[model samples]
Target chain A: MTIEHSILGVIASRPCTGYDIKTEFEHEGAGMVWGVSFGSVYPKLKSMEEQGLIQNYRTETKGRMKKMYELTPKGWEALHKWLGELPSYPSIKDELLLKLSMWDRGRPEDRQTLIYHMKNRKEQSQELLDYYLQWPQNGHSSISEFGMLGIQYVQERLETELRWIEKAILQLEGEPQPPVQDPYDLIPKQQERRNLAINPPVITVHPESSTDEDRV
Target chain B: MTIEHSILGVIASRPCTGYDIKTEFEHEGAGMVWGVSFGSVYPKLKSMEEQGLIQNYRTETKGRMKKMYELTPKGWEALHKWLGELPSYPSIKDELLLKLSMWDRGRPEDRQTLIYHMKNRKEQSQELLDYYLQWPQNGHSSISEFGMLGIQYVQERLETELRWIEKAILQLEGEPQPPVQDPYDLIPKQQERRNLAINPPVITVHPESSTDEDRV
Candidate 1:
């Protein structure tokens, strides 16, 4: 979704400046999930204002002036509708998995690099989850609740990924042990061999010596 | 990356027509990770040929003609550079987390939706990973290796996420018992209050008298 919708969602609750929205990301732990940048937020907010979804007003605070934003009636309606239609779950477009699909053709070193990156991410995710639990944020439980939830989500995913990395590392080392069944299992069955011969049958005897019965 | 690059990487391993590339994604296991469509592959092949990354030739076979493609030296170089460059790891941009981040101001129902969404995603991810691992590949260890690596990565992440979902569900239910704490520990120290008074302390007389005069 566009940053506009995200910022509007924030503004829908209460009026805020672009800086306020940026600060809100850190304050509310949005950085942990959405990863919005001020660069994208401000421009999108301006465009939203232009589109009449939000309205801006100048306000003086401690001898400084700032443009604070508020959702317009239209914006409120739009945000409400958006919220109503919001998908129940998160949609992920993971580029790493996409790259892994081509791993067979990729250089072994590249696969190693991907594994290395995931390892670091996994550790970071685990640490963050631990840190969240250690903090014991009671006063801001309202906010921390979500942060805790996200940290939990991320940490679990990371740990799962670390296992995959270890497995990948093992696989890259060499071909895994093959099953120790009879090697003949790898060969085709007799009926299939007979069918293959019949399709393009080669005569052991010369064609001139072959009788009609042999040909048949 | 673009589908063209993905196609290029696949073709660089061996000459293949657009149909072959499509088949690679469809019939082969490539679709599990690297997805490409026939409509896209044909256009990209045309573009690559025009750019000299590949060359096409036609051959007659049993009164029929077949078009074949082979990578040019330039294509190999391009693929080489792509392989050498840094690979981007997967990014999870979950919008539900965005909503959950706002749970502080959101209605309880919204938070409930977010929780349920995460739980569903956890289940779905696990299912997909399990399905990917069901096949028993014997000879192509590389494919099996990378395939399992990708699947396990996602599977472990799902388990991690499931834990988070459980945590969130508990929090939404109540204060989560503030985790467990041993009563044997000494009472925690009180935090010092910050001084934010607008005016300095007043030099007022004591209720009974002046403090200095009383001491004298």
Candidate 2:
């Protein structure tokens, strides 16, 4: 859904109330892959309303107020007909890889902390997969099939990522411990070391092996 | 440092002008795993200047003008502070996954097209890795280390994705042919047939035969 810009595409298929759209979102497997919360949806709907991409009407039904939404003709045209291009592949902005880039700059202990974090994240992904699989498949069968495919796709990819993370951990674990460098012992080639202002070198240490390093 | 945001963080360590910054970005293994263009960088620098995050001075040397850039105190503060936070993990959002998700909606020809696209993408990733390895590794030791790490990571991940693509192609290839359904095949039970619209009809065919019925 995120890949296809399908949320808008799906909504544009017909006029629907907010609840109806939410039902479609959950049942059609879109939610399984491109997650959205009520918090996210309502705001987006309101914004779309403001943009005149969609319109809404309020009605009283069985003593309850219902707000229904519909794509304007322009919005429908924009969704199915316009097809403005977006980047084909999604780019990652992951921070863990950045930490790995700077891992050598830190103490051996600091690097180990990053490894632990990745291990924990991998475990959580597996747990989520298990929970997703346990969902009952008793109703909305077509939607269920679609939802299952999306879930399976995510789970399989996560498993692959775990394999990478495990390999990375192993590599980091096998690396020789970085030797501590003493600022006083290593002098500059031309400039007098004393002439440069040296901030008290705070060494990052392994969170487990060196408790003092974790004071912050 | 797409994953780490480390490229920019490292740059913020000292003030240098745009050209100097570009050199640093290129030398730091950034181009290997991630990319930034003069178009992106110049605009960002201009924005940052407006935001007071960076300051620049024009200096003339050897009859040429050079603009030197340095982080404002705020920029240095922001950089060091962000350094304490862990970098995000990388994620791949392959378009191939999107096409695969809607395989049931596509014609057999579409499936083959998807397979071809995946194969091409896999080959492209591999070729990129190979080209990166041929790049000269001298003078810039840390950046070279980054390049080596990036090559290893990308190559391994691409191999895993390629295996999945191969499996999908094989599965589709081995599908048993279906006894094609006709518009007027038989009189249907109104209730059951109505229910069928809510649930896609399952494909039943010889294990190795191609089937027109829904597979997903």
- Among these predictions, the greatest lDDT belongs to 1
Clashes of 2: 17
The candidates score, on chain A by TM-score, as follows 0.59, 0.57
lDDT of 1: 0.56
Which 10-residue window of candidate 1 chain B scores lowest in summed lDDT? Answer: B187-196
- Cα RMSD for predicted model 2: 11.9
For candidate 1, lDDT tens digit of each residue in A145-182? Answer: 45456555655555566566666666656554332222
Q: Can you give the lDDT of residue B210 in candidate 1?
A: 47
| Positional deviation of residue B142's Cα in model 2 after best superposition, in angstroms | 3.0
True contacts kept of each: 0.27, 0.12
Highest DockQ against the true fold, candidate: 1
- For candidate 1, the docking band is incorrect
Backbone clash count, each prediction separately: 4, 17
How well does each candidate superpose onto the true structure, as a TM-score? Answer: 0.62, 0.58
